[model samples]
Target: MENFDAIVIGSGQGGNPLAKKMAEKGWKIALVEQRQPGGTCINDGCTPTKTMIASARIAHLLSRSDTWGIRNQGYTVDLPAIIARKNEVVQQFRNGTVKNLEKAGVTVLMGTAVFSGVKTLTVTMHDGSIRELTATHIFINTGAAPFIPEIPGLRDVPYLTSTSLQEEVKVPPELIILGGGYIALEMGQLYRRLGSTVTIVEKSAQLMSKEDPDVAAVIKKILEAEDIEVYTATTTEKISGTQDHIEVQLQTAGKSHIITGTHLLVATGRNPQTAALQLSKTNVTLDEKGYVQVNDQLETSCPGIYAIGDVKPGPAFTHISYNDHLILYKNLFEEAELSTKTRQLPYCMFTDPQLGRIGLSETSARQAGYPVKVAHLSMDKVARAIETGETAGFMKAVVHEHTGQILGAAVIGTEGGEIMSVLQMAMLGGITATQLRDMIFAHPLYAESLNNLFMTLEK
Candidate 1:
């Protein structure tokens, strides 16, 4: 039996930083990771996917090079090369994570951890050894995994997931994605650009169902413009096929439809990684959906134990996971009063015209009884978008009608995330719509659209 000041089960964004910081502060910390040390964001999620997306984006741009007045014969996408580069990037991140923990003197345990009792754990090591550990404090940041929905014959057929797809060396000639969320859209666009005929089947009425109907509609239009087929309000009844030749039976509006593709990707969603933890042995509570129940301070019902990042309920962005560590660390070590509440939620969907959002949506604001005036501008209105010839989205903000406060905003265009961050800073500083409307920014930049955007609310 080994005892430590803290035992972090999962070296995710939150857990790793906390473990390192705790160890540096002279607290004995043991960080257990079942797979790669860097967790999902580094090993599979953001790092690998975005690295491949960069390659895909270049392919897309070159395909439409004529519009940009660039003369080129043609170029072919090398799937193996793209996968190799992505693997290199992922490995780089993994190496850094391991180095950081080692330098901080954290005991990095390569094993799967399960609870034995309150503040106690039994780990099954990768080398087939058992290790018992108990800690004064325990943090669970196991993160999430790609969810595979249950459908008839799904298990019998070889299907790809968000993670497995990234490992594939060959691009599917025809790809069918069985979800319409951000992950599905990203992977769909990636494969489509890599020379695959991509089809997205969304059970909801629209893609990105959480976004406003108009937002989702515009996104669907963008994808369709790229020759990607989208099927909404469609139920996938069953799946049947072998690798490189997959078949799916779908039902839509009470009509049966069948589709076949070279590959099938199930990108429904991700559930918290709590199933492996024997929480039943402790007082920690979980929601009906299996997410760890934590307070604003990230404390579980079980004393001295906490859950952070995607393991707990709420938004599951990498930034959110990283910020969880800040909140927990400040509260525990620095005696700083902090919490998850009242923290602005910002997220970006990495489509070609990225969907960057923060705070409430116009739809959500109105539903919440906020009297809001909306500012809207099409991407064509922005000089930069016009010059780049990539004008395909909009910039929108919701402002308090009376106070002129920016309530929420969404940017869906080229470099949308960067543009949205400018607005986020404005919101953080409590800058009103009137002030932003007159602010002078460098001309012909996407951010200059903010002036024109906020100007709409006044008119």
Candidate 2:
């Protein structure tokens, strides 16, 4: 048996940094990881996926070389090479993370851990040995895994989840993606741009149900314009097939139909990876959906045990998880008062015309009983968008009419994510829409459009 100041299960964005910070503070640390060092974001979620998406984006641009006054007869996509590059990038990140943890004087253990008693764990080491460990404080940051929904024949047959799809070297000629969430939209655009016919089937009435209707509409239009088929409010009756040929039965409007594709991608969603931890032995309590329940300060039901990242009930973005680390570090080590409740949520979907959002949408602000004013402008009105000929989306901002404070904003166009960050900073500083409109911004940039976007508000 070994004892440490803390035992951090899962080397995720939160756990890894927290473990290193504790070690740097002269605390004994046991950093455990069953898989790659850097959690989903570095391994399968962000790094590898975005690398491939960048390649796909290149393919898309090259395919449209004519519009850019460039002459290109045709272009070919080497799927294996693209996937190799992605793998190389993932390896670099993972190696760096592992090295950093080792240098921090952390006892890095490769194992699956289960709670044997309060503050005690039985770790089944990767080399097939059993070890015991205990710590004063335990932190769970196991993160989440791709949720493969139960569709008849889906499990028995070979289908790809978001994780498995990352290692796929051969691009399917035709791909059918299940679920129209962020994963589906991203992979749909990715494969479609990579010269595959892609179709998205979503059970919800609309894609990205959390967003306002107009926001979703713009994304849908962009996908459809690229010839990517989207089927919303559609249920999958059953799925059957082999790798070369897969079929899915669908039900919509009391009618049934069949569609076949060369490959299947299940992008439904993700579930927290908590079942294996055997938390029953501890005082930690989980919610109905199996996420570790935590307070505003991110402390679990147990006094010294904490939960962060996707394993806890909250937004499953890497940035959120990293922020959780900051909150815990300051409060635990620095004796600073900090809470996760007040942090702003900002995320961007990596579509051609990226969708960057922060805080509430117009729909949400009004629904929450805030007397709101909205300002909206199309990308065509932006000089940079026009000069680049990538005018396919718009910008929108929501503000409290009485307080004049910017509430939320969403941008969907070229460099939309960067443009949205400008508004996000403004919101953070309590800047008002009128203030933004009146301020002079440099021309020939997507951010300059913010002035026009705010100016369109009711005067």
Candidate 3:
């Protein structure tokens, strides 16, 4: 048995940096991975998908070039070139991660690990060799995978998950996506912009079930305006088809209907990649949904084991995953006290007009019994949006009614994620809606519209 000071399972956002940094501090660290080194975000999730989305956005701009008085013949999309570009970007990120880990003197083991006993792991190497390892601290950052629902014939027929779709060398002619969450919307819009006929199916009453109804409405309008079909409050009866032609039987309003597509994408949701870890052999606890259970410090029920990233129950964002490493590092090596409970949770939906959100929503604030004042502004009112002629959504903010504190904010328009970061800083600094209204912002910027946005709360 090879013993180490720490063993990190799954070289994900949390595990990669944690193992590297811990090893840099003269602690023996071993990072084991079953596949590529950089985990899902680098391989399939963010890096590759966003690279393809950038190409799609360029296609959209070219199609609408006439609006900007540029009269030119339309360009043809080179699908193979797009896929090549995405592969290049993913390789760069993966290579950078590997370089960093190697420079930090981390032992990189390419294998699958299962718990043999407390603080012990049996690693099955790629070449079918077995290695036993023991460490004082073990971290699980295996991340999440697409949760394929139990629709009839879904398994028998070939369908694409969010991960596999990015690798397609040819753009889908007719794409039907199951699930109307951010993944579905982003991928649908990405393909639709790339010249595909897109339809979205959601089991919930609305897309983005976590957002306020008004925010969801704006998102729906933005999508439908682009000729994308959206079906909410719908149930999938059956999924049956081959790769060339796929069919989905749907049930809505007591009626059954069918839709056919060249490609089917299942973006229903993601589940933590925890089942194979054999946590039962150890004292670590998991929730009812199979997510690892951890305290505010992110420590598992077992003393030296911790769970971070998508494996834990909280937010599944890349930034949060990286922060988890910082928290663990500071508390352990730097003698600093830190916790995950008090940190801000923020995420962005990278659709054409992005949706950036931070902190509480109006629904959550009201449900939490906060006397809230909601300030809202349609994108049309923003001078920058009107000037750019890309106004398609709105912005909303929830404030504590009595204390005038900025509780949360959402932006849905061009560069929405950047604008939301501006608001996040305000909220972090305890800047109130009143202060934002009176605060002098440079003229005609999307952010300057915040002055007018907060004015509506007074009206």
Candidate 4:
């Protein structure tokens, strides 16, 4: 049996960084991965989705080139070319990830790893050979997979999850998406712009239900304007499929409707990738939802065993997973104080006129029993938005009425994701609205929206 200072399971954002940090600390480390080097974010999730979104956005603008006073005709989006470009981007990053891991002196074990016992792993190599390794510490960063509900006949039907959809190069004439979160919104828009008839079925009352109701409404309007059919407060009663097309039986508001599409895409939520790890052998515990329970330091119940990313019980974001790396690394080597509880993270949905929020929303703030003051500003009033012809959303800041300290912010507009960073910093640094209002901002920028938002606050 070979022993090392540390072993990291799964080579995604979380595992990769932790392995490097431990190795840099002069610890012999083994990084195990069953698939490609980079985790889902690089291989299937964030990178590919964003690349496709960029192509779709460009296609959308070109389709409306006449609005820019350019007389263009016979514009078409080359779906296969877009898919080819996405694949190239994914492959480049995957190769880079492998190169970096090798350069960092981390042993890359390409196989499925299972817990033989606490602090021990039995890896089954692709060639059908098994090897056992022991370590003082083990980090589990196995990410997540798309959550498919147990609807009758849904599994046997031909459908694509987010992972499989990334590998598809052909565009179907009609696509039916089942969910209304970020993935559904993004993919729905992409397929629609790429010349596919897209339909979205959301089981909730509002799409992007995690966002504030007003912000979600704005996004809903933009999606409808793009001609992507959206059905909210609906449920997929049953799904039947032939080799070429899928027939969906759906019910909404006491009415039954049947929709037929050439392709079905499931954009539901995700569940932790822990089933394969066989956690029963370790002291690490799982929550009711199957996510590994970790403390603020990212340490699991088992000593020296940590969990990060979607497999852990927290927000599942790439950046959050990266933050988990920093926390674990600091506690292991550096004397610097680090914990997940010390950070204020932000999340954004990448759709046209994106939706982003950090800290708390107005609803959550009031529910927490704080005397909250709200400052809401519509993007129509911002000069930059009017000049760019993208004024279709709003920004709202929630603050403590007495102290003027920014409590939270919710934004929905073009460049919403970029603009949220400023508010996120303010919330993290405990900056006040009065300070933001008095700060000099550059002229004719969407960031000036924050200045306008703070100006409306009651001092």
Which residue runs of candidate 3 sit more than 4 Å off their true CA positions?
Answer: none
lDDT for residue 418 in candidate 3, whole number 0-100: 89
- Which candidate order results from sorting by TM-score in descending order? 1, 2, 3, 4
lDDT, candidates in the order shown: 0.92, 0.91, 0.92, 0.87
RMSD after CA superposition, every candidate: 0.9, 1.0, 1.1, 1.4
lDDT of 2 by residue, 1-459 (tens): 899999999999989989999999999999889988999999988898899999999999998989989998898899999998998998999999989988999999999999999899999999999989999999999999988888898997789888887777777889999998888899999989988899999988889989999999999999999999999999999999876899999998779999999899999999999999999999999998799999999998989999999999978999999999999999988888898878999999988899999999999898899999988899988889999989999999888988889899889998788988998999999888888888888876788777888889865
- What TM value does model 1 have? 0.99
True-structure Cα RMSD, model 2: 1.0
Q: Which 10 residues in a row give candidate 1 its minimum summed lDDT? A: 450-459
lDDT of 4 by residue, 333-383 (tens): 777768888688798888887777888888889889989899899989988
Worst 10 residues of 3 by lDDT: 65-74
Q: Pairs clashing in candidate 1?
A: none
Mark the regions of model 2 whose C-alpha exceeds 4 Å error after superposition.
Answer: none
Better of 2 and 4 by TM-score: 2
Output the lDDT of residue 423, model 1.
88
What's the lDDT of the predicted structure labeled candidate 4?
Answer: 0.87
Please give the ranking of all candidate structures by lDDT, highest first, separated by commas.
1, 3, 2, 4
Model 4: weakest 10-residue lDDT segment is 67-76
lDDT of 1: 0.92
- Candidate 3's residue-wise lDDT over 1-459, tens digit each? 999999999999989989998998999999999899888889988888889999999999889999888887879989899999999999899899989998999999899999999899999999999999999999999999999999999997889999988878888999999999998999999999988999999989999999989889999998998899999999999988887799999999989999999999999999999999999999999999899999999899999999989999977788999999999999998878899978887789999799999999999999999999999999999999999989888888999999899889899999999889988999899999999999998987899999989999988
